[model samples]
Target: MSESPSSSQQQPAVGADRPPALLVNNIEVIYDHVILVLKGVSLEVPEGGIVALLGANGAGKTTTLKAISNLLGAERGDVTKGSIEFSGERVDRMTPNDLVRRGVIQVMEGRHCFEHLTIEENLLTGSYTRSDGRAAILNDLDMVYGYFPQLKERRNAQAGYTSGGEQQMCVIGRALMSRPKMILLDEPSMGLAPQLVEGIFETVKRLNEEEGVSFLLAEQNTDMALKYAKYGYILENGRVVLDGAAAALRQNEDVKEFYLGISASGRKSYRDTKHYKRRKRWLA
Candidate 1:
């Protein structure tokens, strides 16, 4: 009924058989030592697998990524409970630089390229964490350009002048230069054309299949995220409310009505439903 992966694309799925690239076990994050943001959230990203964390704004999606990448400390946020493991090692206490050295990198929301730097320079910055020679870095640069030819054309342009799509590609290209085993991407589709979004996701899929790079992407575009991610977790009020394989989630009734804006009931649309009790049940 299904075709097996060809030899070239036969990367093993993360499961009991193979350990995941990232494991977040019931992590709780607090901001300013009093305000709780993440409430016992947990998820997994399989080696070379693409996982999507889906939610609305303030649903703790970015907070969750920050927690895993050890970035919450900069914002006066801390993980007060639970642990995070990357590649079977404890990383909850490791600094962001330490985590990067260990093949974990986070591409923050807003495509944070140095506005003053040239496109090429911004990409070069990601290689600073590596002790590898310039030759290797150049090779990786070419590789990234191959995935994003637009960046190659505008290599000399200042990052601030580049289009949003190109800037997004530049940031991701920079991350790839680090030779990451996994990338924690946040809100990749924000403020981009639909076609540009598709192209970016396509590149991500190619990298996952060809380079065996894993991704844990946080996105609010449910339809697009589920289309690209192999598995997905939906967050509501700072906790995972639903999670499953992407295909199954795409077909789920509640997910359809609430997230995708596709109502399952024939009577009326989810937004058109005025009953709070009914909406609560659907979300539950």
Candidate 2:
């Protein structure tokens, strides 16, 4: 939040040597050609870097992801202004299927797997865009199982029957089958226990480190997200009000009190302190 030099210096600069994996520049999204959701939003995901998009409910995080993957059209939403570039190519005009071929895949917020299909079948659907042969696909499947042993154990079970956490892993594993250059992940910790959230984030960190995959993750779990991401952006009312390295964000007093729900004195129950509203510095 502060953008001080010390905070900015806490982490290594992202994408300093090469181009970013994805870049969204001054983009705006409108629904039904009337209501605007995103107001001149801009951000970047460095190649092979993990960046977190943090915000509360109705913050337009999902809309931003949908815009990147070109799924806005399904909801009568369109990017009326600005540009989105992936690997230096303009993708604002590309279809969702085309984006998949270009290695930009999105794991939606709800972990939308095929409810009627088995976990394995749902995972196999991710490779629909690939023509790389069965051997590669089989190898990737093995790799997915390696990352998620739980998913491997439940591979034969129907996806609709699996636990929420397992379904989360299944969607992410399915995304991996596409061999994505950048993944737009939304709210991965939605309905899981704290320990399960921690496990998922650890796996995400491992994937980023070992697979050289870049990620633009939108998460409501501020603490966990900042813990795993190298850099982060805080979205408020569809606008990026603050952005900095994860270390800096963690140390920021404003981020601690608001997003992390930590006060200067100590941690308190946010629900109990509903009347004690603190003004944001940016808004003030």
Candidate 3:
């Protein structure tokens, strides 16, 4: 198994030959000019690769995604340190709209579809930033529907009335409408049943393979994230405590015990007597 990188060391580039789709280097995020949310976080998504940002709630996953997408300003948060580059160009200074126009789009957590709009209408909004003409937009819309055939069935339904699973699909289809080269997907499995989660991930894999869209997925579902992602970084209180190839991370004793609820003996529980002690040792 491959060794995981320590918090202080940058992860070695995944696909060294291809330029990265996204690069975040030692970034710090400060909110309201006083609260430090992210501390020296860094990661990369190689072109056409899927990288998972795995962590428990409040581990700074969303903040990291916001930082990359330049959505921090709205929350009075700022990337106070380091640089973010897309396709080798500095983009931390760019506006979120500009970032979207440059082929980087973020599908935010909580499936933020417009309640009053039809599912198709919500998807069409993603193409608003494009000037590539109606024919291209319509073609892309067809492409999104192809990937999400259920959305096609409910194309005219109001987003407010859709099921959680269909709403999830709608949001992703909306992002697809932008024709993004790289997508920063935050918590794609939240608030869904297990079967739906599996379906969503399978579709994500298909999109990655067929559409060639690189993904930086932020998720609390570590097991599922590792199952689909090629590489992964585990965050603890805003810092990357561990990172490695997915298979290596799955095999890691620390990851198995703390994250996956498994150990050499058998399945483990957080209430185990040595839980905190084990956590301290892993973080150390």
Clashing pairs in 3: none
Query: Any idea how many clashes model 2 has?
Result: 0
lDDT of 1 by residue, 183-250 (tens): 99999999999999999999999999999999999999999999999899888877877777899989
Collision pairs in model 1: none
Candidates 1 and 2 compared: the better one by TM-score is 1
What is the Å distance of residue 74 in model 2 from its true position? Answer: 0.3
lDDT of each: 0.87, 0.87, 0.89
Query: Clashes in each model (backbone N, CA, C under 3 Å)?
Result: 0, 0, 0
Off by over 4 Å in 2: 1-15, 265-284
Q: Please, what are the lDDT tens digits per residue for candidate 3 over residues 248-281?
A: 9999888887788777877545566342211111
Of 1 and 3, which scores higher on TM-score?
3
Best by lDDT: 3
Q: If the candidates were sorted by their TM-score against the true structure, best first, what order would they fall in?
A: 3, 1, 2
Candidate 3 has a TM-score of 0.91
Task: Give stretches of model 1 more than 4 Å off.
Answer: 1-14, 266-284
Error of 3 at 37 (Å): 0.5
Q: Which stretches of candidate 3 lie above 4 Å from their native place? A: 1-11, 265-284
